[model samples]
Target: MRAQRKGPRRRRALITGSLGALVFALLTVNILLGSYTVTIPDFLAMLGGRTIPGASFIVMETKLPQALLGLLAGASFGVAGAIFQSMLRNPLASPDIIGISYGASATAVAAVVLFGVRGAGVSVAAIIGALVVALLITVLARGRGGTGLILIGIGAAAFMQAAVTFLLSRADLRNAQDAMVWLSGSLNSANWERVAILAVALLFLLPLTAAGSHQLHGLTLGDDTASGLGFNVPRARLLLTIVGVLLAALPTAAAGPIAFVAFLSGPIAKRLNGGVASLHLAALVGAAIVLAANFAAVNAIPGISLPVGVVTGALGAPFLLWLLISSNRANQGG
Candidate 1:
C-alpha cells in the first residue's frame, strides 16, 4: 500500500529531476563552452566578480544573456504549449501551430519595420498582437468547438506569416536586417535588458499558468466532462488561452518566435515522462532544447552563427511531418 502510494510520485520526481539536471547542464555548457571558452574555474571567478580580460566581456555580455534568455523563453514556450495542447486535447493545438507565436511575430515585425519601434516597445506590440489574435480566434470559433478553433488558428497563422513576409519586403536594408531577427528568431541581440524583461514577465506569468494548469487534465477529458468535474469550461479555457498567448507572445517578442519551442516541448516532455503531460517537465525540456540548439548553431560552422530559430525549424519540420503521419495512421487504425 505504501509503495503503491509512492509509485507515481517517485516516478514524477525522478523525471522532473532528470529534466532539471539536463537543463542545468545545458545552461552551464552554453555559458562555459562558447566561441571563447571560459574554464569552469575562471567562469566561477568571473561570476564572483573577477574579470579575466577578454573572457569577462564575452561571458558577461554575450553568452550569459543568450543562455538565460534561451532558458526562460524556452520554459515559457514549453509551459504555454503544454497548456494549450492539454486543454484542447490536440497536439496541433500548440501556440506555434495555432498562430499565437506568428501573431506576435507579425506585430513585432510591423512595429519595427513600419513604425520604427525598438527596445521594449516591440515586446509590448507582441503581447498586444497575441491577445488580439486569441480574441479573434475565440470570436470566430465561438460555436465551433476545439476543432473549429484550431482550424481558425491555423488560418490566422498563415495570414500572419504572409504579413511578416510582406513587411520584410517593403523595408529598407537596415530595417530589413532588423526585421529579419523577428522573422527568423535570433538570440544574438540578447542583452541584460531583454533578459530582465522576459524574466520579469515570466515571474508574473508563470504563477498564473501554474494555477490554471491544474484544470488541464479535466479539460483533456472534453468540455462536458470538464464541466461535470466542476471545472468552469469557458472561464478556465479563456484564462488559460490568454495566459498561454502571453507566454508564447512575450517570448516571441524577446526572441522572435524561435521555431517550434512551443510546438515541440509538450510532446517531447510527454514522451520523456512516460506519456504523462507535466508542464514543469515540459518547461525544463524547452530550456534544454533551446540551449542545445543555440550551442549547435554557434559551433556547427567555424564562422557562421545561424539564428537559433533556423536550427529549431530544421529539427521541428521533420518531427511535424512524422507527427502527422503517425497521427493519421493511428486514426485509421482506430
Candidate 2:
C-alpha cells in the first residue's frame, strides 16, 4: 500500500511540474509574438529600456495588457469551473453551462445599452446580476434534481441571449458594432487599466477561494453527507455560488465571455491529475489554456488573426457536446 501510494505521488508531481513548465514556456512565447514581432533580446531590452520607441510602445501599450487579462481570465474561469463541478458533483456543471456567464453578460450589456455605464461600474453591475440569477436558480432547484437546475439555467441563458439580440437590433450601427465586438470577445482593447482592475479583484477574492477549497471538497460528498460531516451545506453552497459568480463576472465584465476556459480548465485538470480533487490544478490549467489559446489565435497564422474567444469556443463547444453524449451513454448503460 505504501509503495503504491508513493508511485502515484511521484507521478502526480511529475505531471504537475511538466504542465507548469509548459504553461510558462507558452506564456513567454505568447508575450513575444504579436502584431509587432519582438526578438527575445529586443523584448528584454525594451523591458529594460535599452530599445527604441516603436517596439517599446507596442510592447508596453498592447501585448502586455492582453497577456495579463488572458492569464487572469483563464485562472478565474478554471477555479470557478472546479467549484461548480465539485459542488454539483457533475463534471458538466460549469459556470458557462449553468447560466452564470450569461447572467453577467446580460447585466453588463444592459448597463452599456440602457444605463450607459462602463468600466468598473459595469463590472459591479455584472457581479450583482450574476449573483441574483445564481441565487434564484439555487432557491428554485433546492430539493430538486440536477436536471431541473440544468433546465432552468438553459431557459435563463436562452432568455438572456434573446434579450441581447433584441437590444442589438435596436442599437445604432456604431453601438451595434461595439456590441458585436464585445459579444465575440476581444483583447484588442486591453489596457493597463483593465489589467489593474483584474489584479485588484483577484487579490480580494483569491484568498477566499483558498479558504473555501476544503468546504468545496466536502460538497462533493453530497449535501446530506456534507451536513453530517458538520458542514453548513446551505451556507457553503451560497458562498461557493457567490464566489463562482464573482469569478465568472469579473472577466466577463472585463473581456466578455471568452468562451470555454471555464469549461475546459477543470476537466483538463481532472484528466491530468487522473481524477484527483481539482481546486489548484484547475486554476493552473485554466490559466495555461487561456494563455495558450490567446497565443495561438494571434500567432497561429500570419495575417489571419481571430477573436480570442473564437478559438476557445470552437474547442470548448465540441468538448461540451461530447461530454453530454458520453453522459447520456453512461446513463443508458447504467
* Winning candidate number (TM-score): 1
TM value for model 1: 0.97
Tell me the lDDT of model 1 at 89.
Answer: 85
State the lDDT at 213 in candidate 1: 77
Error of 1 at 208 (Å): 0.9
Q: Which ten residues in a row have the lowest lDDT in candidate 2?
A: 26-35
Error of 1 at 5 (Å): 2.8
Per-residue lDDT tens digits of candidate 2, residues 1-334? 9999998799788877887787778777777876677888987777786857787777878887888888888888889988888788777778788788888888888888877787888888889878887887877877677677867777787887887888888777876787777777677678888889988999998999888888988988888899999999878887888888899889888888888888888888888888776777787888888787888788778888677888889989999899989989999995
What C-alpha lDDT values do all the predictions have? 0.89, 0.82
Residue pairs of candidate 2 with colliding backbone atoms: none
The superposed Cα distance between candidate 1 and the true structure at residue 321, in angstroms, equals 0.5
Which segments of candidate 1 are over 4 A away from where they belong? Answer: none
Clashing residue pair totals per candidate (backbone < 3 A): 0, 0
